[model samples]
Target: MFIQIAIYGLLIALFPLAIVWASKDSNKYRKLIAVTLFLTFDLIIFGAFTRLTDSGLGCPDWPGCYGQANPFQAHNEIKAAEALMPTGPVTVMKAWIEMIHRYLATCVGVLITAQMIIAWWRRSSLRHSPWLATTLFVLVLIQGAFGKWTVTMKLQPIIVTIHLLLALTLLSLLVWAWMRESPPLVVSVQAWLRRLLPIVFLVLLAQIALGGWVSTNYAALACHDYPSCNGEVIPDLDFEHAYVLWRELGKTASGDYLPHSALVTIQWVHRSFAWIVFLSLGLTAFLCRKHEVLRANSNAIIAVLLMQFLSGVATVYFSWPLAIAVLHNAGAALLVLLLSMLNYRARAST
Candidate 1:
C-alpha cells in the first residue's frame, strides 16, 4: 500500500518535472527548485482551505483515505461516516479535498527528493551545497509526521496549529533553498536594521503562530468588529484558558466544552499582535526599500505586507471569505519568503 501511494506521488511529481525539463532553461535544478517552491506555496494555501472547510478529518486517516490510496476506494466508508453525522467533518466532498491536499503534498515530497539527488550529483559543478535540499527533505519528513498526528490526535488545537506552522516553515525552507541556487542579490543595510532583521523575522513567525492558533480554535469570528472586538478594546478574555496549548478541539484541558471567553482571548491576542507585526515589518521594509540595491526586495516585502493587512481586514469584514482567507495565508508565506531573501542578501553583502 505504501509503495503504491509513493508511486502516486511520483507520477504526480513527474508532470511538473517533465514541463521543467522541456523548458529552454539550461539550469534544470534551478527550475526544479522554483517549481518546488511554487508547489509548496500552493500546498500551504490548499492546507488553509482544507482547514477552513473543516475538512481536516475528511479522510479520518493519515496519508490515505481510510487506508485506501484514493477517495474512490474509500467511498463507502466515507458515506457511512457522513451518514452517521451529516454535518460532521467527514464527507465525500471533503474526503476528496483532503485527499487532493495530501496528494499535492506527496508530490512536493517527491520533487524535493529529486532535488536532493540532483543537487548531490551535481555538487562539483554547482556553487551551493546539496545539504540545503537534504535539510528540506528532513524537515518535510518531520512535517509528514505532524500531518499524521494532526489526524490521529483528532485535531487537538496545539497539534493543528503546529501542523499549520510546520507548513509555513516548510515553505520558508524551500525559499531558502531556492535562494541558494541563484546568484546572490547582495545588498547592504544600516547596522541597527542589520541587527534587527532576525528579530523581525522571529516576530513575524510568532504572529503567524498566533494566527494559526486563532484559526485552529475557530476564533476568527470571536469578535465581529474591526477596531473594536466584542464592543471593547479589551473585551472580556480568558488568557489562562486560551493559552492552554494542549487541548482537544472545542474542549478544555479537562475535556469540558471550551468557553467563549477562551476563544475571545485567542482572537483578541491575534488581532492585537497584528499591529506590532504591521509596525515592525513596515519599518523594516520602508528602511530597506530606500536603498537602490534592496529596492526590489523591499517592494516585494511591502506589497505582501499590504496584502496581508488588507486581507486580514477583509477576512473580518467579509466574515472570512474563502478566497481572502486563503490569500491571507499566501500573503504570510510570501512575507516569509521575501523577508528571508532580504536577510540573505544583507548577510551576503556583509
Candidate 2:
C-alpha cells in the first residue's frame, strides 16, 4: 500500500516536473523551487478545505484509505462507515477529499525531495546552501508525521493546529529559498524597520495559530456577530478550559463536553488578536511600500492583508461560508509567503 501510494505521488509530481524541465528558463532548479512553492500553497489551501469540510478523518487511517491506495479501492469500507453513521466523518465523497489531500501532500513531498537531491548534487553551482532544501525536507517529514497524528489523534485541536502552522512555516521557507535565487529588488531600510520585520512576522504567525485554534475547535460561529462577540463587548469566557491544549476535540482535558464559554474564549482571542496583526502587518507593509525597490513586495503584502481582513470579517458576518473561510486560510498562507520573501530581502539588503 505504501509503495502504491508512493508511486501515485511520483506520478502526480511528474506533470509539474515536466513543465519545469520543458520551460525555456535556463535555471531549472529555480523553476522547480517556484513550482514546489506554488503546489505547497495550493496544498495549504486544499488542506483548509479538507478541514472545513470535516474530511480530516474521512479515511481514518494513515498514508492510505482503509489500507488501500485510493478511495475507489476503499469504497466498500467507506460505504459501510457512511452507512453506519450517515453524517459522521467517513463518506465516499469525504474519503476522496481526504485522500486527494494526502496525494497532493505526497506530490509536494516528492518535489521537495527532488529539490534536496538537486541542491546537494549541484552544491558547488547553487547560489544558496543545500541546507535550505535539506531543512525543508526535514520539515515536510515532520509535517507528514503530524498529518498522521491529525487522524490518529482524531483531530485533536493542538496537533491539528500545529499541522496547519507547520504547513505555513514550510510555505515560508519555500518562499525564502525561491527568493534567494531572484535578484534582491530591495534597498536598505531604516534600522527600526529592519528590527521590526521579524517581530511582525512572529506576530503574524501567532495570529495564524490562534485562527487555527478557533477553526479546529469549531469556534468560528461561537460568536456570530462581528466587532462584538455574540453582541457583547466582552463575552463570558473560559480561558482555563479553552487553552488546555492537549484535550480531545470538543472535550476538556478531563473529558467533559467543552463549555460554550471555552469556545467563546477561543473565538474572542482570535478575533481580538486580529487588531494587532492588522496594525503590525499594515504598518510594516505601508512603510516598506514607500521604497521603490520594495514596492512589489510591500504592495503584495498590503493587498493580501486587506483581503485577509475583509475575508475574516465576511467569514464572521456571513456565518463562515466555505469559500470565504478557505480564502481566509489562503490569505494567511499568502501573508506568510510575502513576509518571508520580504524577510529574505531584508537580510540581503543588510
Candidate 3:
C-alpha cells in the first residue's frame, strides 16, 4: 500500500521534476527554487479547497485511507459509511478531495527533498547560505506531521489553524530561498521604509493567521452582510465561545450549541483586521513606487491586494463560493510571495 501511494506521489511530481531537469540555464538552482515555490503555492490552494469542501475528515484516518494506500482500495469502507449516513463526512466525492490533497502534499515533500539534496551537494559553490534551505526542509517535514495530526486529532481548531500557519511559513521560506539565489533588482528608498518592510510582513502574517482561524472555525458566514454583522453596529458577540482556544470545530468549550454570536465575533474580528492589512499594504506600495527597481513589484502587490479584498467581500456576499474561496487563499499566498521578494531584493541591494 505504501509503495503504491509512493508511486502516485511520484506521478504527480513528475512534471515539475522534468521542468527543473530540462532547464539549460546556468542558474539551475534558481529555476529549481522557482519550481518548488510554484508547487507549494498549488498545495496551499488545494489545501484550502479541501477545507472549504468539508473533506478534512473524508479519510477519517492519517496518511492513508482506512489503512489502505489509496481511495480505490478503501472504496468499500467509505461506501459503507456513506450508506449508513448519506450526508456524512465520508463519501465518494469527499474521499477524492481528501486523497487528492494528500497526493499534492506528498509531491511537494518530494520536491523539497530534492531541494535539500541539491543544496547539500552544491554548498561549496552556492552564493547564499545552504543552511536556510536545510532549515526549510526540516520545517516542511514538521508541517507534514501537523497535517496528519489535523485529521487524527479530529479537526481541532487550534491544531488546524496552526497547520495552515505552518504552510504559509513554508511558503515564506521558499520565497526567501528563491530571492537568495537570484536577488531582485535593487531599489533606493528611505532607510525607514526599508525597515518597515519586515514590520509589514509580520503584520500580514498575523492577518493571515486570523483569516485561517475564521476559515477553520467555519465562520465565513457569520456575518450575512457588509459593514455590519446581522444588521447591528456592534452585534451581540459571544467572545467566550468564539475565543476559546481548545474546542471542536464548531462547538463551544462547554459542549453547548455554539451561538451565532460566537461566529459573528470570529467573522467581525477577521473582517476588522482586513483594514489593518490593507492600510499596511497600501503604505508599502506607495513607498515602493519611489524606487524604479521596485515600482513594478509594488504595482503587482497593489493589484493582488485589490483582488484579494474583492474576493473576501464576494465570498461572504456570495455565500462562500468555492472558486472565490480558493482564490482568496491563493491571493493571500501571492501577497506573501510578492512581499518576501520585495524585502529580499531590498536587503540584498543594500
Candidate 4:
C-alpha cells in the first residue's frame, strides 16, 4: 500500500518535472522551486476549502481512501459509508476533494524530494546553501506526519491549527528560498521600520494561529457582528474552555460538548488581535512606500491587508460564503509570503 501510494505521488509529479525539463532556461532547479512554491500555495488554499467543507474526514483514512489510491477504486466503500451517514463528511464529492488534496500534497513532497537530490548533486554551482532545500524537505516530511495525525486524531483543534501553521511556515521558507535566486534589495529604510518588520511578522503569525484556532473550532460564525461581537461590545466568553488546546475536536477534555461561549471567546480573541496586526503592518507598509523596490512589495501587502480585512467583514456579513472564506485563507498565506520577502530583502547577507 505504501509503495503504491509513493508511486502515485511520483506519477503526479511527472507533469511538473516534464515542464522543468522542457524549459529553455539553464536554472531548472530554481524554476522547479518556483513551481513547487506555487503548488504549495494552492495546497494551502485547498486545505482551507477542505476544512471549511468538513471534508477532512471525507475518506476517514490516511494517505489513501479506504485503502485505495483514487476515489474510483474506493467507490463502493465510500458509497457504503455515505449510505450510513448521508449528511456526514464522507459523501462522494467530499471523498474526491480529500483524496485530490492528498494527491496534490504527494506531488509537492515528490518535488521537494527531487530538489534535495538536485541541490546536493549540483552543490558547487548553486548560488545559495542547499541546506535550505534540505530543511524544507525535512519539514515536508514532518508536515506529512502531522497530516496523518490530523486524520488519526480526528481533527483535534490543536493538531489542525499546527498543521495550518506548518503549511504557512513552509510557504514562508519557500518564499525566502526563492528570494535567494535574485539580487537582494538594498533600499535603505530608517532603522525603526527595519526593526518593526520582524515584530510585525511575529505578531501576524500569532494572529494566523488564532485565526486557525477559530476555524478549527468552528468559531468563524460564533460572533456574527463586526466591530461588535453578536451585537455586543463584549459578549460573554469562556477563556479557559476556549483555550484548552489539548481537547478533542468538538469536546472538552472531559468529553463534554464544548460550550458556545468557548467558541465565542475564540472568535473574539482572533478578531481583536487582527486589528493589532492590521495597524502595525499598515505602519510597516507605509514606511516602505517611499523606497522604490520595497514600495511595490509593501503595497502588495497593504492591498491584501485591506482585502483580507474587508473579506473578513464579508465573511460575517455574508455568513461565511465558500468563495470568500477560501479567499480569506489565501490572503493570510499571501500576507505571510510577501512579508517574508520584505524581511529577507532587509536582512539578507549579500
Question: Per-residue CA lDDT of candidate 4, range 204-298, in tens?
Answer: 99999999999999999999889899889899989879998998988988999999999999999999999999999998888888878788999
Instruction: Give the lDDT of residue 26 in candidate 2.
Output: 83
lDDT accuracy of residue 45 in candidate 2: 96
The C-alpha TM-scores of every prediction are: 0.96, 0.98, 0.96, 0.97
Ranking by lDDT: 2, 4, 1, 3
Task: Give the distance in Å from residue 143's predicted Cα in candidate 3 to where it truly belongs.
Answer: 0.7
**Which residue segments of model 1 deviate by more than 4 Å?**
none
In model 1, state the lDDT of residue 150: 92
Question: What value does the lDDT take at residue 115 in candidate 2?
Answer: 98
The candidate scoring highest on lDDT is: 2
**Ten consecutive residues with minimal summed lDDT in candidate 4?**
182-191
Residue-level lDDT tens digits of model 3 in 1-350: 66777678888888888887898968888898889899899899889999989999999997889998888899999999999988888998999899899988888888888888888898898886678888888998899899999999888889988998899889989988887787456456678887999999999998898898899888999899987888986888778888899888778888877788888998998989899999998889878888888888899999999999999999988999999999999999899989988887777665
Candidate with top TM-score is: 2
lDDT of 2 by residue, 59-108 (tens): 99988999999999999999999999999999999999999999999999
Deviation (Å) of 49 in candidate 3: 0.6
Please estimate how well model 4 matches the true structure, expressed as its whole-model Cα lDDT: 0.91
Please write out the lDDT profile of model 1 over residues 1-350, one tens digit for every residue.
Answer: 56777888899999999989998988888899999999988888899899999999999988788899888999999999999999999999999999888888899999989999998998999888888889988988988899889999988889988888888778777877777778766466778877788899999999999999999999999988887996899999897789898888989889899999998899899989999999999899898877788888888888888888899999999999999998998898888888887777776665
Clashing pairs in 3: none
